[model samples]
Target: MSQSLQAAAQRLERWIKEDAIPLWLERGIDTETGVNIERLDVTGAVDREADIRVRVQARQAFFFAQAYDRGWCPQGKDVAQKMLQFVQQHAAHPTAGGGYTHLMNPHYEVIDSKQDLYDHAFFLLANAWSYRAFGDAAALAEADRLIAHLDKKFGAANGGWLEGDYAYACRRQNPHMHLFEAFLALYDATGNAKYLARTAELFALFQTRFFDESNGLLFEFFNDDWTRLADARGSWVEPGHMMEWVWLLDWYSRRSGRPVQAYLDALYARGLAIGQAPSGLLYDVVAENGDVVDTGKRCWGITELIKASLVQIRSGHPQAEAIAIKAVDDLFTYYLSASTAGSYVDRRGADDEVIVDVAPASTLYHLIVVAVELLDHCEGRVQAR
Candidate 1:
């Protein structure tokens, strides 16, 4: 690694371990409920009255578990256990068969009991991470129960699961993408071939239902039959999702001995071509025809880019190391706050103005993932040098 990149990695490690993780644990947790607070203002005040989404709860749990795994936070296991207990207590549908509820009020009352694929996927992820972090048998059993419930309730005839009960004419690929992520984590935690088999099935669905061979972009919405929608939603593409898939596909290949170079190359090229802004940050949304639909840049998108770049660099992609360095530089320059110590500006408009003033607790997961990956990358590069 270049001396500059090595220095950048060190800075990121300090920020995550010393600033971000501690800040979140202190201000982002709801002490009364033992659940995660939804957001923190620029001044680091918690949003106490905000409606807590189950996915956010799960993501925060996953973050702390990951932080513990990376040795960045000593109290990560305790935080994760608290968060997981809270989720199990309040997030489950009270009268419904077995899936998690969508949202809960500050007082831990279920506000929305609608079964959502996205929420279930994150619930599974939270369980997997909790099991891995603390050897919680209940967490693993809950993961299995959630998987069975998802298959029973939301299973689609075409292969992938349905979005939810409120599904319109189009089904989204986002939930399935997350399920793929959750299954991979489950397989890693339990050494279960069933999870691996399920992941492979989702990958096949990505090729058949999600990926657009015509333009190399992944479509966001599909019809009831898994065909791409003909309208604007069908043409919508997210660069973040492409980069995320690139990272996952690479991981899958390494673990399963699957050949995914073609998909990876196409996704990487298309992501850069359509998703990248002049600022070197990823645009929020683009049309399949390469028009910028939403000119917003989000913190999560940049994190996905960092992850994909690191994966590519490990694979010896010629330009990946430079791309990863530039991404790290941008992350520090625009997203990381100068005065807030640990908080970040979550969204910026196309003109580079701050769109959201408050930092989201959910974003901590993305930031921690990038920091962990960069730490390993930098260490490997130093040893190689």
Candidate 2:
């Protein structure tokens, strides 16, 4: 491992162990309910009025479960269990499907009861992580039930799953990407061929629906018939999503022994060319033809870019370590909180100034993904596919 990367990894490890986890454990959780708060103020206080999205709860559960596995938090598993229990009590949908509702009030009353595809995918991922971390049998069973529900209700007439039960003019590839992620998580958690088979189905969807083979751009929105949704600005794409897909593609390659270097190279290269700013942060949105439609930078985008760089390093790309080191440095300098320790600035304006003051607990999921991966890479636990 490069010395710079090792140093960066060690620093990140300390930050997570000492600052981030402790901060969230104390402030991010609601004292009355034991569930994670949806947001935190600039001073690290919980925003108790904000409605809690079940997706955020799932993400926080994922973070805690992952922390337990990493030995970063000894009580992480219990915390995760509490969050899941809270989810089961309040977030359960009224439908027969195994999915949860989209939103709940601060006091755990139902706010938005729609059974959302995105939230379902995340809860599955959370359950997968919980099962992997603690061998929780119920988590595994719940994951299976969720998958069955998805197959029964979410199955679409075209290729992938429907956006949700709600009506929409266009379908989104974002949720499908996350479902692919959850499938991989399930496979890793249980050495099951069924999850692998499901992942392969999503890969096929990628080839025929989400991915544009001619130009290599991942379209975010698609018509009901699975055609690209476009406007005067052209088909909208996200560099962050490209980087995220690159990481997932690399992970799939590691597991399935498939060669995905071409896709990784194209998507990462194009993402950098179009979406990455001069300051090393990634833009929130961009056009297919390389125009920056939105110049704001989000914390999640930088985390995805960091994960992509680590996968590149594992692939033995010559400059990956250097790129990754710089990305880590840039992440701290530009996005993460300097004053607040665990909390982070969620987004930045076009001029690279911090625009968002509130720290949403949901972002901890993104940060933990990179943190654990970087720690593994630096410790030589990461193996090249």
Candidate 3:
């Protein structure tokens, strides 16, 4: 790590800790109903009418739990538990099967009852962290039960899980990536070999299905049989997913002793080469062969890029530190600092115009993760942000 990164991180930490944390805690949660706010308008006012997605609720719970574990907020656990309570109370699938619904209204009604794989992944992740933050036995039990529900509802006869309760024509590696992430978190939180075993399966799935060895890139959409499923735009790739996998592979390697350097190196190189805009922002989507599929950018992708750069810096990549520093600066300048305090610009268009002005609650997970990763990398070298 360079001295410049440490300095830049300290400044970023101040923004995250001193400014952003309090603002979200104060305005992000509904005091009366306990529903996590879905988004904040450009004026930093909460969107009271937007339906809350289960994934957003789960992610906010995870953030609060993580904040508590990291010693950033004293009441973080209480807030996390409150959010968890809201989800469990109202978001359950209206069927006999376990797992949660896809969406809920702010006033505690289930808006969508369809069981979604992506939402359940975050449900497991939130519970995993909830168990870690306070040793909540029920949280661990919920995660275990949810895993069973996933196996029962979404399990694939061939390999990897389905899109939801009903099989979809297009399978996504993104939700599976999140499930891999949740399994890892569960393993870390509980020291359970079963969760780690689950991770191993997902890792193998990534190698055999999600990853493309021919181009050393991961594609987004896939056919029912896990074949490439891009439309007129050729194999569509998200630079953010590439970076996310780089960080995740490093995470898996830490526990499994897997040799994943090649996968990491290839993804990182290709993403930096073809996935970034002139402003250094990772575009929302790109074609397999170095074509820009979408010129738009999103806040979550920037955070993932920062995390991947941080992982590279740890692995002693030559330019990793500099890249991470620039990414951190860009994160604030383009997304975090540019918007209203406690809120962020969600997406920017081709011309770098703010297209979505509300701060989606799901996005807070990405921001908090970047902040936590930075704290881990720069700890002890500098005072707490």
Candidate 4:
């Protein structure tokens, strides 16, 4: 590896080992409950009622699995195993062909049963990671089961998986984007041809169905029949999602040895075209005609941008790296906070109140992952220079 790449990886390792994991372990981890809090305030107070989502659980599990895989957290094997068991016992529901739910009560009771391909994507992600960590056949089997179910239930006639049942039988770009994430992880972990095939198929879906080739932006939200919705709300452009698609496209290209440079460059340009304000933070949504729509700047959007940029940098796109660093710096300066007493709050609400989400595991996990990715990208760039 290049010197820059090595430094970037090192910085990411330090952040994960020093900042992210420790905070999560001390504040988010509920020793008595065996799971984490759903929402944690800036003061590190847990909100029991906020409730954990299966996706959140899966994210935490994946983090732990990563720690194990990289030898960062010793004896991480048992921790990963426990996390898997907790998810299987608490999140998995045996109904309508037995799919996972997003929200669960503190007691691990399923309060919501509606399935989303995005959530399943995370499960597949977690299982794939766990399989890598422990070489667990059962975990691999579970991942395969989830993928099979997704293919049968949510897979659209035109290649991509449908978004889910939320907001009716409507579809969205978000879920398919995440499914690509899962497929990438699955392919890397198991060398599964099916996963790679799914990845290619979904890439086509974006290129043909969702992506606005002329505008260089993705069209979010769709009808059950894969028809694009006409409402401004439906076509809302999220720069963060734009960034994510860029990264995923780059990833898919590298994985399949197919070049999508033009597509990646277009998405990056489009995302940068819709810049943010008050902090240079990317907005949550924009109009179909590229007009700014939703102004709420959430933590997840920033994370996606950072991830996308990092992917670009790592794959020999310095411009993408610069874009990512600016966005991440803005987010860190304005949004991220690490308390003196080891508490952490990664989000603030519209009213400036701490958006204390109890089960913020997924958001937290992605944030850490993105941060690590950015650090790696910068280090690589610095060394290259």
**How far is 67's C-alpha from truth in model 2 (Å)?**
0.4
Alpha-carbon lDDT, every model: 0.85, 0.87, 0.85, 0.70
Per-residue lDDT, model 1, residue 156, is 86
In model 4, what lDDT does residue 31 have? Answer: 67
Ranked by lDDT, the better of candidates 2 and 3 is 2
Best to worst by lDDT, what's the order? 2, 3, 1, 4
How many residue pairs clash (N, CA or C atoms closer than 3 angstroms) in each of the candidate models, in the order given? 0, 0, 0, 10
Can you give the lDDT of residue 183 in candidate 4? 83
Give the alpha carbon lDDT tens digit for every residue of 1-385 in model 4.
3444445445546666777677677766666555766766545667666767767777778877887776677745666677668767767766756568777887777888788877887788888888877898999999888877776877677667666656564677787887788888889888878889988888888888789888787888877666688665667788878888877787787678777878877887778777454465677777766676755667777777777666666557757645655665555555555552323445544543445423255665665566556554544532221
Question: Considering TM-score, which of the candidate structures 2 and 3 is the better prediction for this target?
Answer: 2
Clashing pairs for model 3 are none
> How high a TM-score does candidate 3 get?
0.96
Query: Which residue pairs clash in candidate 2?
Result: none
RMSD of 1: 2.3
Cα lDDT of model 2 by residue, 1-385, tens digit: 7788988888778878898999999988876787888988888788989998888889999999999998999989999999999888877887665788888888878888888888899999999999999999999999999888987988987878888888876788999999999999999999998998888888888878878878887788888788776664238888999999999988888888888898888887888888889888899998888888899999899889889998887777787788889988888887675478887888998989988979988888988888888988777786578
Off by over 4 Å in 1: 167-169, 381-385
* Candidate of highest TM-score: 2
TM-score of each: 0.96, 0.97, 0.96, 0.87
Model number with the top lDDT: 2
Q: Give candidate 4's TM-score.
A: 0.87
| Consecutive 10-residue window with the lowest summed lDDT within model 4 | 376-385
